[model samples]
Target: MTKKLFWEDPYLSTFTSSVISVEENENWPGKFLVVLDETGFYPEGGGQPWDEGNIGDGYVSYVFIKDGVIYHVVDQDPGKGAIQKCRIDWDRRFDFMQQHLGQHILSSVFEKHHNAETVGFHLGTETVTIDLTMDSISDEELQKVELEANNQIYKNLKVQSLFPSVEGLKELPLRKQPTTDEDIRIIEIKDYDYSPCGGTHPAYTGEVGMVKVRKWEKVRGNIRIEFACGLRALKDFIWKNQQINSISALLSLKDVEAYEGTERIYRELRDLNKKYNQQSRLLLEYQVKEYHREAEEYQGISLVSLVFEDKDMKQLQTLAAALNQYPNTVALLAAKGDKAQVVFTRSKDLSLDISKLFKEVIGLIDGKGGGNPITAQGGGDNVANLQGLMDAAVIKLKHEYVK
Candidate 1:
């Protein structure tokens, strides 16, 4: 078995290690999995990502462990002969350490305080998450968790990792049982929490910087809380503050007053939208009056047809419905834009198949829609030929109904 140097000193970023073996990769040309006698790099496991750095003359792109041997997946093959210097990316290793420790602290708080069990965990590059065994956690409860987690950091409590015997583990008050009974590593936060974890961690809780629960969502009958800590939490806070400052300046309000100011503007926009809708309806009603006057008489029935530019579908419905007051009239209208929209409607007295007429005319522009015998609306790509399509429909209706 390879010596796990990281377990001895997680702070060691550089080391000298002899190559135990080098296996050439057939799938990835110019790549090799090199096994070392000892290593400081952490493998991707237990919700924490793998540590990245360089070994020998090539870049250490990946790291993994299999059958008690730690493999340094390198881009270039380092000949298996002598000792080589191994380097660990402290930024990445420490970040994961902070995040992993932060998760331990957070899950413990939720479990200890609210009796919520963390059933799932994922330590991502942008955010870390833990699925709590709860349907939902209220804002008030989450706030309390956040406050206490940060307080733990402020307390600067020592964090110890203990490897308890298989038989002795039964005595410890573990937050949760370990997956494997062989090697159970328990993390103890002094006067705070004791939980089983395989991932690395900082020496003290203060190194976690800050633990912030950003948001939560319901998933798999539980609440998944998305959070961040250390440098990631700092970055998030900086970005959010920048955005808030920009919004506050644009609203001509102080940082504290920005929310209320934005809410006021949003409410104003809603009122304006409602007022515009009312005025638009009145304008469409007047336009329908003008269209009714221009109707052509055929077989004692008025045929009102017109082509409008960029009119809404609702306007067409309202116009068609308003024109329906005329005893025996048919309304064939089109609104032109990138595409053409046509509406066909008749008064209650005329039991004509406007849907059939619409289907046929709409085919000229290759469009599809549907409605009953009295009213129908459709759209087509042939906007330029909208008037011609309406003329054809009107002529066909006249030939059929005209006496």
Candidate 2:
């Protein structure tokens, strides 16, 4: 069994130890697994990531444990030597320590105040999240938990890691029971909290700096709280402050007034859009009247077949519906811009199956569409042939059905 030097001195950055064993990692090519007599590198376990740094000449990329043995995945094979130097990346290690401890304090607060249990935890690169037993929590209630968690951090209570005997475990009020009975490791947060954990943590709660719940959402009948601690929380604050300042300057409002100012601007834009749509509808009605007047009459059927430039398919459908309101009228419309489009419709008084005629014409433009006998619409990339497609529809109607 390898000695866990990390448990002895979590802050130990550099140490010398013998390279006890070396083996090629079967799963990772060009990588070697090196085991030392003692190590400060924390293996990936307990919802905490593995510590990465240097082992002799090799860069340690990942660390893991298999059947009670810790393995360090190295980029290069640290040669056969009696003693090799190992160094822990302190920044990465301490950041994880802060987040891990912050989770303990926050979880304890949730349990104490709301009678909620922490069902899951994930320490991500950008944020840490804890899944709680409760399905929902009010903002005011969450604010209380956040304030209490930060209060514990400010108190700077002593954090202790204990290896208590199985019999001795009955005396402490642990937040949760350990999964294993043998060799149980417990983390006690002074008088605040106690729980079984193998993850590394700082000596004092103050090292966590602060605990801020960024947001929360319900997931699988539980509430998942996304949070940040210490440096991560500080970085989050800086980014949000910059955004607020930029918005305030742009709107000529104070930081506190930015929300209201943005809301007002959104309302004005929505109202303007409503007015523009009204005016556009009025213009389309007038254009429809002009097109109806110019329609050609063949055998008592008014054929409103026309091609427009840069017109949207929605507008074409609206025009077809309007023209179909007239007696014994058929609207065959096409538009050309980035693509060719066709819309065909007939009045309720007529029994012309325009869908069949629509199919024959839209195929000229390599388009696909379907509709009932009264209306059909489609578009294709053959914009240059859109007018020809419209004319084909008129001929198909006059020859096949209008007769």
Candidate 3:
């Protein structure tokens, strides 16, 4: 088994260790796996990613543990060397440290106050998430949790990781029991949280900077809270502040009143849309009467054919249905726009297959559609030929069905 030096000193970035074994990774070509007698590189485990850096001259792309041995997957072979220097990317390592510790504090507060246990955790590239046992958490409750978590960071309490003896474990008030009995490592947040975790963490809670809960949603039977810590929290604030400022400027209101101003504008727009829809229905009724009056009679069938500019398909269907109310009437309507649309329908009294006639000419505009013998509608990208599409449908109806 390799000695996990990272557990000894989480802040350690560089170290010299003897190369225990070297082998070409079978899963990945052009990559070598080198095992060290001792390593400071943290392997990808416990919802945290692996540390990336260099071992000798080769770039260490990934680190992982297999059967008690930690292997550093490198871009190039470090050659057979007795001792090689290895380094972990400090920025990435420190970021994980902050996030991991922030989670400890945040989870402890939830379990402490709300009786919610952190069932799952994920340290993602941009954010960290914890799945709580509770299905729902109100905004007021979350606000209190966030404030308390930040308070823990402000306290700068000492965070200690130790392998406690069996007797020592029984005395401590742990948030949760350790999974293993032999080698139990507990992360104690000084007089506060005590949980079993093997991941790296800062020496003090203040090193976490801050913890911010971005949002939360119910997943499975639990609530998953998406939060950011340290520099991640700062970046999130910066972007959100910019967006709020932009919205306030657009609303012509103070930044604090932007939400109310947006709500007012949204309500006004919704009212206007409702009024517009009412006016549209009234106009369709008037047009239906005019279209039926102007229909051309063919073999006792009233063919109502017309075209409109930039019209909605729903409106076209409404107009077609209204015109078809008249006896022996067939409506062939098309709308010209970026995309062309056509709707064909016949009265219930008429035995013509309107869908068959519409399909034969829909391809002229590169469109597809189908419906019952009474009604059919479709649209296509060939906008310039929309009127021609309608003309063809009208002619096909007169030639094939009107007879």
Candidate 4:
């Protein structure tokens, strides 16, 4: 079995290790299977990313483990006999170490204070998440845990790793039972925590620096807490402060007053919308009165023909419905805006085939429409053809209805 160097020194970024094996695997192309006696490259497992860097002069693309043997998948073969110089990206390695260590401390505190077991864990790019066995944890209780975790950080507690036998592990107080059978690697944070973890972690609590619970939510009868530590926490703080300043300026309000200002603006907009709707209704009512006065009574029918300038389709529909009370009347309404709209309606006896008439009339203006036989509505982007539309409607009415 290949020795895991990360467990000994999580901060070790570079090391010299002898290659134990080199083989070609069908699964990976242009890559060699490099097994080293010792390595600092943490394999991609336990929700943490694999360590990326160089082995000798070649770049290591992927680090994986098979049957307890860690393999460095590199770009070029460093030869089997040569001692490869392995180097890891120290910034990423240390950040992960801090997060992992912080999780151990925080998880320990949760189990100690509330008897909540750490059901799940995930180490992400920005933060680490720990799922508690309980359904919920209030904000006040979460703050207390955060305060306690940071206080432990200030103590500079010693974090030691020990390879204990199954019998030896039985004597120690572990937060969670060990899953492995070979040899349990127990990480102890002084008197605060003891857990069996194979992942790399900080040597001391002070190295973790800080732990901040950024957010939390309940999931599957458990509470998942998302947190950041060390450099990640510092970056998150800087980004959040910048966002607050930007929002304050864009809203033209003090940082403390920004949220209230936004709410006030939303309420004003809603009130304005109500006033606009009332005004539109009144305008449509006035237009309908004018249309009734100008209509000519023909053959026991009120023939209302109107031409409106810069009117919308909604106003036209309102006018059509308002004139519906006139028995045996034919109402022809037209409006000119970005487009020209025509609405034709007739009372009971005069069954105007508007769908057929629209197809013919719309062809002249390159438009399209569909409606019931008694009342039809059609429109086109030919605003200049407003007069033409009125003329066509009159001609079509004379030809189709004035029999």
Candidate 5:
């Protein structure tokens, strides 16, 4: 077992300890060794990240635990029985302290006000999460918890850690009973809260600065609460406000007026789309009128077909439907936009083999398309070959349907 200096003094970032043992473990590559220390270095466990810095001028790449022993994985192995100086990155260590302490206060508030238990906890790089036993906690309820937690922070309550015997714990009004009998380290926040936790925390609640609930959601019959503390919370607020200001400027509206401006723009776009559809329908009707007059009659069978420069699939289908209304008539329409779109339809008593014709015509243009027999559709990217496509459709009709 290693003496956790973080529990003794959370502010201690540098210490001197003798390396009692240094032996490489086979399970780890590059470097692996455990140190029997007198002081320093918070191990990576209990959901909080390990302290990062140097041990006796050697870089500590990873710090972890195995069977309650803290193992510092350094880039260069230090000789056994050597006295090494250790230093932790204070900024990162302090951030973990603030977040860990903030969680203690927030969890206490949930237990006090709603009888909820802190079932899970995770300390992340940007935020900290605490999972409560409650099935659902509304936004309003979460706000109440936030308000109370920050209020306690403002009060600057004294926080103390004490090891009490199993019999001694019976006298203290604990929030939850400890599962283990091994020296229970109870963290008491004045009159506010008392719980058994081995994780590092600040000496006073005020050191946590401000607690803000960033967001929350329900997970596995519990409410998972995400929050930030101290500088983290402050930074999040500043970034979010900057985003809102940018949105207001882009929309050309005040902060309060942005929503209404967006709604108005959406409505105007919908109305413009309706007008555009009506104009397209009128244009298609005129094209159909011209086709009726120009169609060629063969044995009482009128054939009106043309390949137009660059038109979409929808326009080609509309033209085919309009020309097919004439009895004993057949129309084959092909339009090449970024790609080619073709539609063919025949009136009663006229049958056109469109699938075979598309394979023959489109294949010459190095494209692929196919459709049904009486009415066939195909397309490709050979826009420059519109004339060829029109001539081919006419030839196929002459050979297959005109007879």
Candidate 6:
């Protein structure tokens, strides 16, 4: 069995060890696993990701434990039977340590205060999430849980990892039962929290630095609470303050009053949008009347063809519907924005399949969209040739219907 140096001292980031074996990893091609007689690289386990660092000159891409051995998968081979310098990424290792410890305190606090047992945990790169068996948690209750956990951190309690014999374990009051009967490693956070964990951790509660509960959501009858800890907590704090400062400056308000100022701005924008929409509708109504006056009749078919600047597809549909109100009328409208949109519609009295005709027209510009016969709409990159597209569609109509 390999010597578990990490369990011995996770703080030991750098060490020199003899490579016991070297084998090409079958799962990940081109990479090789250099097994050291002892290593401090914590392998991926217990909802915690693996540690990565340098194994000699090569990169320690991944680490995993199987059958009581630490396999350091390296990018470049560091031959067998050679003493190689191994260093764990201390920043990453310490970050995970902080998050892992934070999880324990948070979990213990929830159990003690609310009797909400943690069913799952994930120490993610961005956030650490703990899933509780409870179906729901109120805002007030969640705040209390967060307060309790941070208080634990503030207390700076001594955290101990003890290996107790099967007989000795019966006397300890563990917050949770150990899953494994043998080699039981118990992590006790002073008198506050006690649980079984094989993962690495800091020696004291203060080392966890701080913890913050960001948000929570319901998942399959469980509450998944997302949070950040240690460096992550500090990072989140910095980012939020920066954003608040920017908003406050733009709104000409104090930092604390930024929220109120933002809300006021939102209301003003809403009112402006409402007024803009009313004016646009009135304009479209006037435009439809002009179309009715200029409508051209061919073989008793009243055709209204027009194009507009920057009008959306919704406006095109509205204009088409207005023209269809008249008998035997066909509305062919196009709007130009980044692209050219063409809409074709006919009254129920007409026998035109605009969907098929629109499909053939859009092929000229390599564009895409479709609709049924009564109303068909599509757009293409032919912004400059909006008039040309209209002329082509009108010619196709004249060839089929107007002799």
Please, what is the TM-score per model? 0.81, 0.86, 0.91, 0.72, 0.72, 0.93
Ranking 5 against 6 by TM-score, winner:
6
Over 4 Å off, model 1: 15-37, 54-86, 134-140, 218-221, 282-286, 312-329, 345-382, 400-403
Q: How accurate is candidate 4 locally (lDDT)?
A: 0.84
In model 3, which runs have C-alpha deviations exceeding 4 angstroms? 80-82, 312-315, 366-368, 379-387
Highest TM-score model number:
6
Give the TM-score ranking, best first.
6, 3, 2, 1, 5, 4
For model 5, what is the C-alpha lDDT against the true structure? 0.82
Q: For candidate 6, lDDT tens digit of each residue in 120-207?
A: 9998778899999888888999898888899999999998898988888888888889887777899989988778998999999999
List, residue by residue over 13-124, the lDDT tens digit for candidate 5: 8888888787777766777475857556788876788887787877886787776678888777777888878888888888998998899899999999999999899998
- Tens-digit lDDT string for candidate 4 (1-403): 7888888788889999998888878888878888898888999887677888889988888898889899988888888878988889888888888999999999988998999999899998866899999888888999999999999999999999988887888988999988878757999999889998888888789999899999999898888999999999989989987987898899988989877988898899999999998997887678667777778766555778888886678777777877765676778788887778888776666666756676677756666676887778888887787678778877777766666
User: Looking at candidate 4, what is the lDDT of residue 151?
Assistant: 92
Task: Estimate the TM-score for candidate 6.
Answer: 0.93
- Model 2's alpha-carbon lDDT is 0.90
Per-residue lDDT of candidate 3, residues 69-124 (tens digit): 99999987777666888888999999999999999999999999999999999997
Q: What are the C-alpha RMSDs, in order, of all predicted structures?
A: 3.8, 3.1, 2.4, 5.7, 5.3, 2.1
Clash number for each model: 0, 0, 0, 0, 1, 0
Query: Where's the lowest-lDDT run of ten residues in candidate 2?
Result: 76-85
Model 1 scores what on Cα lDDT? 0.87
Off by over 4 Å in 2: 16-30, 56-59, 79-84, 277-294, 317-328, 346-356, 363-376
Decoy 4 TM-score against native: 0.72
Displacement of the residue 69 alpha carbon in candidate 5, Å: 0.7
Q: Rate the local accuracy (lDDT) of all candidates.
A: 0.87, 0.90, 0.91, 0.84, 0.82, 0.89
